[model samples]
Target: MFETMALMPQNFSLPDAIWRLLISTGLLLLAIVILRTLTARFIRRHVTSSELRGRLLMNFRNGFLLLGLLGLALIWGDQIRSLALSIVAIAVAFVVATKELILCVSGAILKSGAGSFNLGDRIQVKDFRGDVIDQTLLATTVLEVGPGKTSHQRTGRMIVIPNALFLSEPVINESFTDHWDFHVFTVPFKREDDWHTAQKALLAAANRHCKPYLESVRTYMTKVGVSRGLEVPSVDPRVTIQVPVASEIHLTVRLPAKPRQRSYIEQAILSEVFADTDYSTEKP
Candidate 1:
C-alpha cells in the first residue's frame, strides 16, 4: 500500500499553489473589509459624539489594514521569499555587469558633494596635473598643465581621466587664489657661496617685483582670514634658507602674485636675482 501510494504522483503544482495563495489572500481581505464595515456601522449607530465616532472608525480601519497586511504577508510568505531571492540574484548580476560604470557615477557624485574643483581650476591628481576643461558623470577632461610643476604652461594636450580615480586619489586644487595668492620658488646655490648677500639680493628682487600688489594682496588675505576665522601669514616677499644636501643650499623664496602670473613673476624675480648675485666662484 505504501509503495502504491508512493508510485501515485503527488498533487503539488505551481499554478495550484499560486491559485491557493491568491484565494487565501482574497478571502482574508474580504473578511477584514466585512468586519471593518460592520463594526464601523455599529459604532456610528451606538456612539453619540461624532468626533469620538470618527476617531474610532479611523482607528478600526488602521487596525484592520494592519491585520490585512499581516494576513496577506503570511499567505504569500513562501512565494515572496522566492521572489526576493530572484530579485537578489538579478541585482548581483546587474552590479557585476556595470561595476566600472557604477563607480564612475559614484565618483561624479562624490566630486559634486565635495565641491572639490570647477572648470578652469587647476588640479592635480596623482601624477596628472591640469586645468579642468570639462566634467561629466563618467570622466573629466583636462588641459595638461605641466612639462613640470613650476612651468605653469599647458602642453596643449587634452587628457580624459576616469572620474573613478577621484574615489581612490586625492585632488589638489592649485588655483587657491581668485585675484592674488602666495607663490613660492627655489634658488639653489653652493654652500660655500655668500649666503647672506644672496638672501639680500633675492629679497630685493622679490620686493621690487611684488611691491605693487602688496597692499591688495594683504587686503584680500585679510578678508580671507576674517571669513575663515584664522590669521593669515604675511603676504610680503620673504626668503628662507634651507640646506637639504651637503653640496647645495636652497633659498626658498615666497612672494604674492596673481594666480595667472605666478610663472611670470617667478621668472622675473629669478632673472633679476641671478643677474645681481653671483653664486659661481668662477669670474664670468
Candidate 2:
C-alpha cells in the first residue's frame, strides 16, 4: 500500500487541502496553548519584577505566534517558500499600518523603564495638565484638571494622550518627587500704596500657609542639589518686586505649595493682604 501511494499522483483535491488546513490550524492552536502555559509558568517562577514579567509575556506572545505560523507552513508542505514570502509581506504591511502605534508602545516601554512618571502623577504635556489615571501600551489617561479659572480642581473630563508625545514633548511632572510644588503668583498694587507693608504682609502669608512644606522641600531640594550638582535655592517664601508699569507695583510671591492647594493658598494670601488696613490705606 505504501509503495502504491508513493507511485500515485502527487496532486491533492480541494477537499483534501481544506481538511489538511483545518487539521493544521487545530494543531497550531493546541501547540500555542501548551507553549503559552509553559512560558507563563517559567516566567512566573523566574521573573521577579512586575514590569519585566509584563515585557516577557508580551515577547512570549509574539514568539508563540511566529512559531505557530511556522508550524502551519511545515504542515502545508509544498507551500513553504510562498508561506515565508507571505509572512514577510504581512509583517511589512502590519508595521506600515501601525507605525505610530508601534512608536507609542515603544515610548511607553521607555517611559516605564526610565521611571519618568508613574500613575497618579500630575503631569503637564503641552496644554494638558492632569493627574495620570491609567497607563497602557499606546496611551496614557489623565483625569483632566483645571485649565481656565479652575486651578487644580478636576474638570470631570478624561484626556487620553498618545505615549509617543513623551518622546516629542517635555513632560512637567508636578508630582514627580512629592506632593509639593513651587507656586508663584503676582499681586498688583498701586505705586503710591504702602508697597513695603504689602510686601511684608505677602511674605508673612506665604510663610504661614507654606510652613508645613518647608522642611520636606528643603530635604528634597538638598538631595536634588547634591545628586545633580544643581543649586538648592531657599525654600523660604520669597517676595520680589517688579515695576512692569509706571503706576503699578507687582509683588511676586514664590513659595512651596501642594499643587492642589495652590489656589486656596493664593486666596488666603490675597484675603490677608486685602484685609490689612495698613496696606489697603491710600497714599494720601
User: How do the residues 42-148 of candidate 1 rate in per-residue lDDT, one tens digit apiece?
Assistant: 99999999999999999999999999989988888888999999999999999999999999999999999999998988899988999999999999999998887
What is the C-alpha RMSD, rounded to one decimal, of candidate 2? 15.3
* Candidate 1 runs further than 4 Å off: 1-14, 37-53, 194-196, 275-278, 282-284
How many residue pairs collide in each prediction?
Answer: 0, 0
> All models: lDDT?
0.89, 0.85
Which lDDT tens digits does candidate 2 get at residues 86-118? 999999999999999998998898889888888
Best by lDDT: 1
Task: Give per-model TM-scores.
Answer: 0.82, 0.60
Best by TM-score: 1
Candidate 2 weakest lDDT stretch, 10 residues: 275-284
